[model samples]
Target: MSPRPSDRRSFLKTSVATAAAVSVPYIFTSQDARADEQKSSESNDRPLVGCIGTGSRWNAVGPNAMQLGDVVAVCDVDANHANGAKKKVTDIQSKKGVQRDVDVYEDYQKILDRNDIEIVTIVTTDHWHSKIAIEAMKAGKDVYCEKPLTLTIDEGKKICQVAKETGRVFQVGTQQRSEMGLKFLQAIALIQAGRIGDVQHVAVAIGGSPTSNSIPVVDVPSGLNWEKWLGQAPLVDYRWAKEGKQTKTRCHYEFRWWYEYSGGKLTDWGAHHVDIAQWGIGQNGDGQGASSIEPIYAKHPVEFKDGMPLQDDRYNCATNFHVKATFDNGVVMDIKDSHQDELGFNNGIMFTGTKGRFLVNRGKIVGAPIDELKDNPLPENAIAEVYGGKDPARSNAHMANFFECVKTRKLPISDVFTHHRALTTCHLSNIAIRLNRSLKWDPKSEQILGDDQANAMQSREARKGYEVTV
Candidate 1:
């Protein structure tokens, strides 16, 4: 039955109200109404979005952003990336007959300063994630940041706190949480329904961190601001080349392999795999992370501190290491390599429960025991319920989720507090590798129990002028 406009509005109001009463910590607040009204009053008549970091992911995100509202501005440290995105947005808008034009910027803060921009899509390298996101939220713009939510544990917590204080809608880019075929819904339902009979262990396999390879320092390409590209990270010689003489910019994807810019594969792939592990284990927001963690022997030989790599060149993160994280519920999450012949890439996770084990990744979900459960029948709208019944195919749905919360003041599904707990697990793995020893952790306090060195690793010194304040 088609509902009346007033009826639909009433339903939305009631849904939002009911959502608020559910005691979800991530709920949006009243400020969203003010923002909405302000947006309506502005003659722009479009939800202006700024893209920060226009590399690979932005290609997917830019078109989606345009469909959602308007890509008014695009920011990238590299001129090529910035101009590329701007041209793409222009082409899409032109083809669609949407007369909107987008401006390009090297500094994201300039985009933040504009009142017209209501949302910022952050697809920068891992290191810049928290710094720019926190600042954008503080600037009164809703943030849609890529995962792993933060580069460090402390950064994750700070982001959570700032979102709470500012009442801005923040969505972490963990699309698996929204992907229907992943059987994320099935897994969550089974776990929540006790179908797995109390999950005792979760096994996640992610790729190893990049190895340190010497690249000669190169000259900084023309039309690119090399210093600004470094952002908050330490200034390093372009490794393979010197400044000014460089033929190409050190801006974009290659930065992932360097410690100064990224956490290598640990933060790269671990962000996705570990996030699933955390979700399946039901550790989100104010929940304890892995109670204790230890590193498993690396199949490939690598230098170690405690169990972490000691070298700072090429790759500073571990290439091969298994971290055992024990949850408070006696659940052990083993983040390790998949048995080569048996599991191949081991790019997914295996959840072991009293009933049996189930494996899931982007493309597949398999289990001998749960095989019967698959055809047994899934509840109607089971997948939709996981996404709060939103369209899963929508690329900007996560951003839409944030915007909806901005107006309704409801917590996003991927709120900061919840993501913080998940990030704790990621950080623990890094710490275990760095320390090269098993360590006790207090998940409740989010600290390394009685270990000064481990505790110190929680936060790092932010580069000058780029420090984040909670």
Candidate 2:
């Protein structure tokens, strides 16, 4: 059976009231969209979508778009990936007895140049997230960018500014926000409801970043735009390798290990865990973040000078570290590679409060307080409430939210402003480790107080012809 009317209203009231009190512009309402727009699903008048960056992660989201709407264009710096994605979209439509002609391109801007596409999915590498997202907003398309939202702290401000100026729907792909029964939102609900008393400390345990030795340079593979792949990043020769055949250390999944293109595990898993941690603590929206950040310990595979890696051959991000941050309200947070010894958990958040504590992860939720809720669990309307009254068991809930918001002009649950705020903490953690020092952050000013060198690292110089601007 579905939830009752009163139960639905009560569930929405929790998040909606909090959103309203803070004046979040895109909170859901009964009149969120025109009645005619809601009928698009029945009439098959779905939005046109374009997929950019059809890498492995992109594979997860590409098919979901096909389920919701027509994917007419696919783009990627790697020709093989782009063409492969186009074929996938074409096949999906054919199976539905619909003939489609999906176009393929290497330059993403070509897809943006088309005025007919209404939505764009950006699953590019971390460094390219903000620039492409900003440009897409300027092109008047609703965007679904995967996390972490920005490569540096400065990119966060640019993304938020452009999103507001355009008034378009911008959703960050943090699926944990919508996964029903994951206990992420449930944890937030309990904290907001005071079931855990005032949250004293939150421990986030994301695993250590990968380490790699210097890789020998190799020739660029055919059908790949090596120059475009390195867009905005300093030009470096390709390092081609495969398992036994040719082990290329800098391509595909290995990109996460390098600081030049991504922030390693700090932004990888940290994006998901840290984002949830901040949300539960009531500090994820605009102008909300830690007041101070301290890098207690760190280790790296390469040397560093002035916060930049000195070597060009090996993975350079911190392999292991612990960062401590304090909020303005005196809430303390510990972000580390693991907490197995300290808390008997390694890949989840441990929220310690005055009355009780609990641990939450993808696998399970465990603790005395949660155990006490044997039969008296979260209300039946909780899933719908957290999802803005939509079905919680949706196979593509995160992408579904983005598509609905595109038509309604309402904010997706994982809005850009909040994602940027959460990502800011992750970026700061990387910076603190690179600098090997503590930092005083002024959340109001969004500045690293009294530290000129650290503040300078907030942004990097984009390569010529690829500079990102607001």
Candidate 3:
């Protein structure tokens, strides 16, 4: 059993040694040497992995995890996904000359019960992320969970507490810190290097969510356990309908638009963009965040009451929003769907500071400040310093970092502590938009000040069977 919350809190405040991390050599940087490195460092002379929530994202992260460790099991509520993942894992191992049959199951607990499984990757839908992750850590397994790691603000806090108590190496799959051509990493380094004078305001144009009209309730798909798939969310009829010869769904990939399962673009994209914004502004740390969040404009396809959508059949999350969040250090972050009309990248972050400014996305980094870097170079170790003293230009990047940290017992680049803080701003933005109001936030306390109803929105009551027990 995990330790009591009080004991955990006491331990954390006094002797939690996250900063006392063990430095690991970049032995897993190349594919040819990764297996040899794993054999040398992992227990029992092999790294064993189990995967939960093998859905759309599993294709990307799951295979990468398999590269560092031998996959032993795969699980999902949908049998099709689980079986598909099993075959994929089996095929990948077959090529590596380590032929083995991978166990497939619908219950995630089965994967946690195995004593040999040292690592687990969670690529589930947004709502189920925190619970499975907490349980895995309690089971003494290291975790690599996908982004938008929590459905609610309080859930993120609970995950962080459990992680510290378990002493597990948990990596949040916000790969922007590690991947996307190293642009985001460089952006952070530039801001810290004072290439841009004091950051005055940052705008994240992550694009608006797609709005869908009333989707007709349809029969649950075959080979799917809808009840278990719903997990902590309230039971609702399976909804699907045709759109331009394509079937749009409330299940699987399209769950992002629903408020019940996900936080739409606010989190779907905010998890990547807002996280960078907070990091660039030095707010993605302990007890640091925006002092106030004002919902400048919010447009929804359906009306909401008490943060719940009045129209049950249509997508309800905010479609277009322009929220202004102010930090205690006198920086402002505007989360919006679009940038300047002339600058139509539609998806990028623009930083404005006293000295200069720049905009960076996955494709490119542009502006005068970036151009000046041709001659006005930063320190050699600038990017590595931002990345916690490791080389970010590795072959497998994020997954490789997780594998390395699993051996060292150190926190990875995107640990839960910083992610929860950055994600709090996203969650708060959703709350302000849902209520159509502004909020004063106490970052130190992690509370929405002066609004009891908004404070209560920080957590949701889990369904009886799906409570996220630590």
Candidate 4:
């Protein structure tokens, strides 16, 4: 039998030292001695990896994880997805002139049980992120989990706690932090150097949450494990349409539109853009967040009570919302959907301060402060400082950094604590919209002050047998 939660936690604490000392290194053979030497010069130590959630989003991260280490196994609730990912990984390895066979599994616990696997990349659904992450940490594997890290504030907190207690190197997949030549880092560096001149406001545009009319339940896809996919979430009928038509709202990409599984764009893109905004505004740490969140304006497809959508068939996340959050430092943040006249990028973050403002997205960073950088550039080591002394020029640097930390035993730039804090802001915005009212927050205590119902929304009771054990 798999170890119990308490046993796993205790094992993690006791076994970490031994595990690190004797961890296996994945070695790849080369066709020639010269080629072998070249590969050896690249890195002698490559950790064994197991990827969970081999779906659409996993396609990107799953491959990237391979670039950092050897993937020995793959897991997914969908049999087709799991098999497809296995083939992809095998093909990639074959192209690299390496002969490797990857085992496929439907249960993530099977991957965690292997003493050979040292790292786990979690690309599962929002609701499964926290449970799998905490369990993986207890299983003594360093983790690289995709963001928005958890389904709710309570989940995020548990993930953070378990990570801390396990002393595992954890990296959240908010790749924007390590992507695009570290543009977000540059923006934050400018802000910290007083370039933004005592910033007063930050505008983050993550697009609108999804909205859909009531969807009809349909048959479950042939190879999908509907029950396991809905782990920790209320068991509902599997919904999908025939091959061509838009079927039920519970499959693949459509899952993001529902409140039961996700927080819509609020957590979908909000996890990315809002995370950057909080980092830029210096509210990206535990006990550092908005002091008050006011729902300036909001609208949803279905009516909600006690911060939950009343209907399960339709997309319930707010489709259109504009919330104003004031931090303890008296900085105001406007998080909203794109508008015709708003001064921000469509799916990016914009920082507004007293002196000047700048906007950054995947494509570019622009505005007056950025323009000024033409004459006065950031310090040469700015990005290095941001990345905790790791070289930012490495290919797929984010995953590379995680691999490095897996060896060095250091925290990655995108750690869980700060991520949870930023996600709290996004969660707060959604809660305010669900209630269509303003709410006060005590950042230090991480509570919705004077609002019991609102505070209660910070967590949800998981379905039996799937509860996330911290």
Candidate 5:
């Protein structure tokens, strides 16, 4: 199950070899930031802020952003969501029993146009993230965007380029890197410390998406702007139907179950667990990631023709999948939709290596290797090193780290660069499954090797009006 008794030299070789090679470069400089906004944000304890896409996730991200900064505006295509967010932010910021009115907008541009706003929290649907985030950075606003950060591999590239170009302190809301009681960080620390000893394989179990019945076409809700909500993707009729009392729609929280909008659980939970897996193995770097992605198995709820789903009325994303991502360094990562409960993992990551193996999730970190930590404790700085050389305790809350970085101008805990590399692997997995084949990848150039058809899936053209602007 594990490696032979190895000498100190070989153990050090396995652990320290990759340590210096993959240190994260977390800081970048921003250009053309307005003097007044910068002065107001940096000099003041709380920054002036805005919130976009205040549907389900905003109940969490909105308050987190508002707690760190004063929310002056909120925007959403849905009037109900926008008005709801207005009350949420005002209630959080208002003193004592008194509350204030927050500005609400159907168009996100108004918030971006404000010279007074210093930061914006983007919790929009997957397709809207890149466009609004890029434009916000150009307008001199720092951003805290939710995860599954890109709709396609090309979107990830554009986001990284603009983040570097604008020098914005952009943070992707992958809280596992900061929160979850630091179990993920501990797992990474153990891997980097040779406790797992040159990890040969990583198994990530994020459960599958659920299949849905054909949701009948219905009139778009009165307050919701159906056209704007479908920005970037091809416009489709509003679909909503009740199944035994539960509402299934083509938008909002259920959007992840549709390939046109998101990548199902591969990106949903993969954004958290896979991000950590790559971070542990030191693959969360430029030009040093998965060399190939192969789909072992995949099953979707609807039929497919040339990778596009045939039915528009049902959830179309893959319901079950087993994808393998191979690294040039001989580490193979297997990402599956789910795992057996009797196998000791339902939703978590299991890292197996030559020396030992351990399992980790939000709840706990356990295995024979973890038990060995008692007599042979890890180096004191192990977790700190995995956490970009900062005290791990400092970033206990993800939003706290984001706001702290907003003032210090340091990189947020979950910066855009590493996230892009991790997300690229997830995107490649979905592409391989959709095409029902394996893929050769060139990490340095960020391309699909030897496959023209597969390469085209890396980017998608937006509808005429919603294209991302440089």
Candidate 6:
């Protein structure tokens, strides 16, 4: 028998209240909880999964759903996106002779209310990551959130805390961690094995930051809940122009170039590259952050004062910028864009060591001065040992890892604590470029030491009613 409407509401309220009582933690477990998870997977008829932020990445997640579990719900601010994912899941289920139906919703909260969902895949923008992941965890659902982890440094810390408290499996969507033969894995292994001969400096080059451009307001499309889409952000009219209606303004994917919505290319790509830098440098936890950040050069599309906009113009971020970060361990990480020649590799992480230097991006890895390392090879089991030696071809491995941990009440590999440290580097770069000055950072306190202006950039005031709380 179907549950009465009142009964369903009562159940949802109780579940949310119970989830809120859990407290997040600072540490996480690295072991796989497959033994416990296997029992649950076998006992249950099938796990019902939900997806939030159904964007382009949905294409990749579709096949994984068929093999892993049932996609019971899909939610997106855009109706088109929500419907698109719903169709995909239904079509796949139909082919398999599964009589299950996938529901669609414009608001993600609707999905959270359904007790049938065991997991949620989050592919929202950077800003929405923490909010949705935290709420989902509280609702007792395991989370598979896309990379760069948190939108802000504070959000990163909060996510870690929430995951620990809820005992929900949370995995950051940095798929390169699951990719085999990548330079990032190889570089870290070499450094750990002392093949790098006391690593001192590393160079990481990502793309540009946002600009100070104010686009004219446009009509919000039918089916798009613009207000809900702007959750946690100030309510503003949709400034994006329709297709073929080109203006001097940018929106959507171009939203990455705005301070309110994103941290430009630094966060967009840095989430991947800078993450690799953090792993190699061994700075993946609390009290483990960069000590200093300096913006050597920046060419902004508009003027600014210590990261604040001076003019309400078209763009608000830097068009070109170079930043240098010094860790307490005396390691210097230089992040810049190489205009000299494109570097052949536009976006990736590069590590330079005393022994040699290696560059790693998606599906590609190359090295220089390889003769010495080629002769003196790394340990046969180094890479596997670092990443727990898991198979790369396992579909949705990162998400699967999170689910395994959820059943055992263990933390996934890309837990919030480690991810926060990585995001700190990315955020600092954006802040430095905006301020266009050198700033001292106190990694121990997670604040900008001695500089009030720099410290203020750590977090922003959430729009009145959209504030996120513990």
lDDT of each: 0.70, 0.80, 0.85, 0.80, 0.83, 0.69
Please give each candidate's TM-score.
Answer: 0.84, 0.88, 0.90, 0.88, 0.89, 0.84
Ranking by lDDT: 3, 5, 4, 2, 1, 6
Q: lDDT winner between 2 and 3, please give it.
A: 3
**Tens digit of per-residue lDDT, candidate 5, span 126-198:** 8789999999999999999999899999999999999889888999999999888889988988887788788
Residue 277 displacement in candidate 4 (angstroms): 1.0
Model 3 earns a TM-score of: 0.90
- Return the number of clashes found in candidate 2: 6
Cα error of candidate 6 at position 169, Å: 1.3
lDDT value, candidate 3, whole model = 0.85
Q: Per-residue lDDT of 120-222 in model 1, one digit per residue for the tens?
A: 9998878889889989999999888887777778898788788888988888887677664646656776666666777888888877754434344344444
Residue range 248-359, candidate 2, lDDT tens digits: 4766777888888889888998889999999888888677899999999999998888888777766787888999999987789999998855466678888888878899
Q: Over 4 Å off in model 1, which ranges?
A: 1-45, 180-182, 240-251, 298-313, 340-345, 389-396
Taking all chains together, the TM-score of candidate 5 against the true structure is 0.89
- Over 4 Å off, model 5: 1-43, 96-101, 340-344, 394-396
lDDT of 4 by residue, 1-470 (tens): 12345544543554444344224322222336335433543564677788998889888998898787888788887778888998999999778875556778778888899776789999988888999999999999999998889889888888878988999999999988887777887887888888879888888788886555555555455566666788887766555543345544676878888878889898999899888888888888767998889998888888777676777656677778899999988888888886445563567777888998888888888898898888998899876777677777767988888888898898888899999999999899888998888999887887888989888989998888998887
Model 3 residue 310 lDDT score? 78
Q: Which stretches of candidate 3 lie over 4 Å from their true place?
A: 1-44, 341-344
Residue-by-residue lDDT tens digits, candidate 3, 145-185: 99899989999999989998999999999999999999999
Task: Using TM-score, give the best candidate's number.
Answer: 3
Tally clashing residue pairs in candidate 5: 2
